[model samples]
Target chain A: MSESNEEKKDEIQLIFGDKRLDGRRFDELRNIKIEAGILKRADGSCYLEMGKNIVVAAVYGPREVHPRHLQNPSKAVIRYRYNMAPFSVEERKRPGPDRRSVEISKVSREALEAVIMKELFPRSGIDIFVEVLQADAGSRTACLNAASVALVDAGVPMKGMITSVAVAKADGVMVLDPMKEEDNYGEADIPFAFLIRGGKIESIALLQMDGRVTKDELREAFKLAKKGAMEIYKLQKEAIMKKYISESVENG
Target chain B: MRPIVLPGDLVATNPKVAGFGTYVENGKVYSKILGLLDKTETSVRIIPLKGRYIPSVGDVVIGIVREVSANGWNVDIYSPYQAFLPLSENPEFKPNKKPNEVLSIGDAIIAKVLNIDPKMKVTLTMKDKVCRSIRFGRIVFINPARVPRVIGKKGSMVKLLKSELGIQIIVGQNGLIWISGDRKKVSIGEEAIYVIEEEAHTDGLTDRITEFIKRRKSDVGIE
Candidate 1:
């Protein structure tokens, strides 16, 4: 069963990676689509779709902090959770939060908090929940991008938008926004976040590479990541603006 | 034509100064200055203004009756506002008709926004075509703000969800969703709802949803 499952996965990869069949470039990302303001129970929510990866994120509050221990008097707290559903991937993930997810949640919160003005909400905390409905290569990056858009849609103030992209070394060649196939068999995967306005790297969360790349290759990867981040930024801006325009019309 | 401000463009009245202009608001490529239409000490209204489907007086909305009263039904508008659909609003509602017969708890209906009083009371009427009863579907709740997202860009998302899952999905602007299909389709519909709810905070959500459906379809085959 395991062997056959592996073979099935391989077959799936071959089908998905048939760029000639799909007419896509190696470095090009799958079609990116975004929808903002998607959760009713939450303050802000958004849905992000990138190829075969589906991620939804909800932002609840700059409201009062719960349990007290997590609260900070000097600044607002930011809580982030990155979770994958049991059936999100081909191999089902366990329901409860895992160590890797928890770690990713912490790093993601830190990265996002750097862009948010915690001083504005003092003592309050913003809770961000990201749910992965499907998994491809760069779920984390997708989550970050979606969370930023949701925050903006919720009218949360920030210095600038936070956008992320993944760079990986696949088949001994560096690629931008590597797909599921590239990520499974690829050597390196680096997901980095950037501030949209100034185009500065805000944080690098998960950087793993089976093999080392030259200094020039690393720089080139960073450059590609930045480019991808900008594109994501454009999509985020468009989503927010679309909401605003429609909202204004409704108000009128 | 005035310079169109793309979604992320930074524009100021004075070209020489940097970082002073109003940031372009959502979905608008360019907004003309066209002189200020109205100005207050703290707020101003500009031209080429955009529109949204916010709840307003007389607007029709789909709602679920969450609670029932002798005189009226309490409707969950799926918005920031709650609505009361009075018995008088239902023309066909016989006095002898049990509230369940007219509209039961969890029954979805189209309701018209009658009056949103200063006290925040939302009065609704079931006197419109869209205000009639909804049949054979499950009601789902979403964030009011995310309604557009679920609908997608020009109705693409809803279309895709309906086609892929083979479900009839009706999305109310107030965040109420009614979905009907076969058992498998209904389960898929529920999963799609959760998908929308979970990923509502992200951009590029449609691609993810499509990918999710595709992956899930393959998974079921594998099982």
Candidate 2:
């Protein structure tokens, strides 16, 4: 390799190594902002700005599933396409489904399906499309959280509010809502989603760790995830109510 | 201390009693102990937790047409369902002419919900006075949930956006917005919409929007 190429690789590795960010303690989540019902064309849509990461989601359906093969007889099928726009990252991601996108899409669909009352629309499907405008480390979790809020914004009947958080092991400590830097050098990573109303874990998408944790460490991680989810739930509720009440006034 | 339970979860019979405990069943972790409800229960009733717009009958939704149909136009309602505006609903409309002349495919319009079928087919009518085409203004899209914050407590937000920008603005719950006035005022109105969308969850949004308008007005030397 050329000296310049070697230097670039070294720089990338250095940024991902042994450096804590701006004294942000482990288990601390960056500030999150969510706006629901942002798209006029989709049935329900939301925009999520989490620190520097931006994600937009549009939900459609509970309508007829087009392909005869994917149709389910008993309950509504949940289909999700978690995509990153070509301009979303430092290097543009190639458009279309790659392995990472497909995996994230599958896990996200499972997470959301846990809270959605699929029985409500038997023989149909709810289509959720998440478009990442900007991506840092925890895009998957952000997409999950944004898609849940968008689903609610669309008024799709879900059993409860679904919120997701990412936990990572940094310097042998578990932190909730790890930022982009923390994720790269982290020893282990776990992303989880829960139903806000009952606190039931709807899904656990990522659980890769270089080192094993004690049972207590895992429990603490779960606690932190729940706390983060609760905070997101408040924002989601506020966004929904603010729209509903104002629209009511306009109609009145 | 006893564990707190959120609504809409099931609890197990011999549930492990601990705060923030997780139980494994069929390869899934039930995060809260309370979610392990009795399996034999006849009906599991999860509360309808409020989050955002739930499409209902008679809702006035503002949308853009994505496609046209012989019977009606297929409008994107920004919901899980697509709305159909039948030509019959537009008594004055004549078919075979340019859809744009009567109702262009991309034209933003506000219409009322006539029926929501079991199939999630949304039927809309544009016969109402407010349901007609939006003209002499620019339409903006915002999160439907932020409409209240944009409008303020009692028409305060809307009133403020209008007076400060010197424009006429109408907000639709379906996330369609129309702003009409001077060019500068129209741009200011659009900025206000952006601010509302960005900072809707934050407190003091009204002040923020007002300040934005003031900054734009002063920047334009209109004081």
Candidate 3:
């Protein structure tokens, strides 16, 4: 084997010391923590942490759309943005949206378009801002998850909460919730989001893939991703209710 | 505590009329958003916990004048779009002076929402009101969501404060509160309002506020 190839193999091995890194089973997801209503200025806001990834999302509007031309006469428009902090990654990322972030932002809006009740407010806009403070592997998924919670927190009418999880094929096994190490060395990575209602997948909001996998592996990956996303769906509800219900009971 | 319902939660059926924040489908009433379920004798609706103020006709709002134009004065009503207050609509407004002379930027006004255009431009009117401008009084801003509770059912909470403290209070639907009257009473009114805003969602809040005002009235010796 070439020397660099040998070194890369060793590094991958070191990162995944056990059969699975972080002592998690291949299908196990990382610990997720979610908090809503963290920002006083924002209409609604949430802070989300998934393993090492940290993201905050704020929702504004369903208010008037500025720049009058962007106004949709029949439905509210979405101004969705995804931004990464300079210190979010291993190497400091630039503070603004890059190619990856732009793509994520576009897809994130598209994903939200499915969840938000656009017909309710015509000629208005709902702006969602997702700011990543720290990034591990599934930062995009984490942001999507956090933004969904923020949308709910902002009291935007929706069909259901959206949850996202990444599935990857590492070695010969398909795994759920890939961390940074697995993300870099995995054979194939599939990130998908589901709008969940009552333990059922209402719809797939986002589906994106990188690398190669068999058709069978693709289906299995989606199944695993859906299962992982369901867990996140529960967490999202818990986070919202933790803020909403408690405030009512304690203060109302 | 009212049971909270999320979007798509089955709330009721044909017997119960679906109200605001709820929709009916296939003989079932489902919540279209996340909020506390409030049921009345003939209807069921959900009261949202947090959100931007979606302007509607007849909502009394507090607005800041943002721009004075030849036709109308543009006001920021704490909503996404700027609400337009026409100089023609205000009975007291005089075209005899420039728009700025009538209402300048940074001046607050207690106005009512006259109409909302399909384009989402809110048209405000200050006509037919005893007080037009919020002059020489303190305006306290709170979450618009809590405004309804602060006023209480049928304005009982606000009425109690007004009678007890002998103050002029205007509660705006957009979460802007105008307090006036005697100088000492205004301060006491402000504190009582702050208390109401803080504990808007608390149970027995009206009684608690009454007790608070009673204590404050005793301390301040306001007759």
Candidate 4:
């Protein structure tokens, strides 16, 4: 099991100067686009494209809390469903929520709860559904971005938005926003989500470790992930603003 | 259509009063929401164009009865929390009758927000004519954010839909729309509401919507 990753790592270090498969720099990321309010029926919706990964997210509720017992008497309960389409990857994924999907959904819900004012709505549920339509890697991070956009579009009063990025260690190199190949061969894969607070991030909403890593590597990865997430965050905000503020203003 | 600002983006660089959506950080005022920057000589704020309905005191909302309790009824007001309608608030309410008898589950009523407690429990009063039961017509839901567009500048767009098409419409602030009329005309009204929902972000939408409605009505062989 470990031998294959080691072999792939050696070959990666020997051939690629930058440790990225598509000739991107170690810190470089793929193109990102976020479209707000795309779904016609959903209360709030967003479509986010990151590199080769496309994720669509929709938000409904603050509506009725179904399954009467799940209702929280003091705050709005958040529910999340993260799914990958059957054709989202190389192998056709099965059509239901698997263990991985369930875990991501739970984690994403917790991360989002930090930004939302749950106390404002009592005994209700706000549901977030994020579907990964296409995946190359970093589906969870893409899902997080799309979900945050959808929440804002739904007009959920959030303290601030959350943005995420994946950082990996390929051999001795620290990389940001790793693609599929880098993720498989990397020594460590850490995904980080930061809460945008007071115009700066002072806290982490979600953190996960997938492989073996040391202390220094974790620190460097955290620093790099923060930088990467900020870049993505700026674009997300711009996309939302453009959707609401700009006119096609082209008819001069 | 003003300048946009994001969370942590600098909204005020000089000495100024920070308003609702701004917080001072390291000598500069930063926005807390992805909002439009509203600047004045003495004060500045960022008005968020996005978000769900946060019920405040005195807001009129369309509520659907979700649960009936012993003393009052639980109402879904399109907020994350439910609102409570106690028998005491409605002076005309008959107390001995069961809650369902007064307001059945799934009944829609217009109510004034009486109070929002510290825990966010909402109290509603069905004392206004607008807060009465929605007896007839179909309800259409749209994004709460797009309501201003549906209502139009000075109630122009909706009034146009009502007068021209001859339909009764109630524009609920909570994103509930009650459209009442015969089937043919109600269908036309429903289409118009969807049209508004779809292209609400575009500028000069009032004229575009009016033109579309006229063409649609003509196509259907109705004046």
Evaluated with DockQ, which candidate comes out highest? 3
The most accurate candidate by TM-score is 3
Off by over 4 Å in 1: A1-23, A198-211, A247-252, B1-223
lDDT tens digits by residue: candidate 3, A1-252: 112323343446412433476778777889999999999888889999999999999998877777889988889999999999999888978777789999999998899899788988888899999999999988989999999989888888887778999998776568899888888876778899988764578789999999888888899998899889888988988898888765567545
State the lDDT of candidate 1 residue by residue for B96-206, as single tens digits: 787667888988787789887653468998787656788776878665545666787798989999888778877776777778877667677678767876555455678
Question: TM-score for model 2?
Answer: 0.53
Error of 4 at B186 (Å): 7.5
| CA error at residue A96 for candidate 2, angstroms | 1.6
Comparison by lDDT, 1 against 3, better one: 3
Per-residue lDDT of A143-250 in model 1, one digit per residue for the tens? Answer: 998998777656555656778888876555567887877677666677778765433344553454445677777887888887787777778767766765423332
TM-score of each: 0.52, 0.53, 0.92, 0.76
CAPRI-wise, candidate 2 is incorrect
Give the per-residue lDDT of model 3 (tens digit) for B1-223: 7887777677777636899888765677777787888877789998877677778999889889988888888998887667999888887676577778778989999888989877677898987564488778788888788889878889898898898888888888888898888888888888988887666677888888888888888898866
| Better candidate number, 1 or 2, judged by TM-score | 2
Candidate numbers sorted by DockQ from highest down: 3, 4, 2, 1
For model 1 the TM-score comes to 0.52
User: Which digits, one per residue and each the tens of the lDDT, describe model 4 over residues A149-202?
Assistant: 888777666767899999988766788998887787667789999987555786
DockQ of 2: 0.09
Colliding pairs, model 4: A122-B81, A155-B51, A155-B52, A199-B8, B110-B131
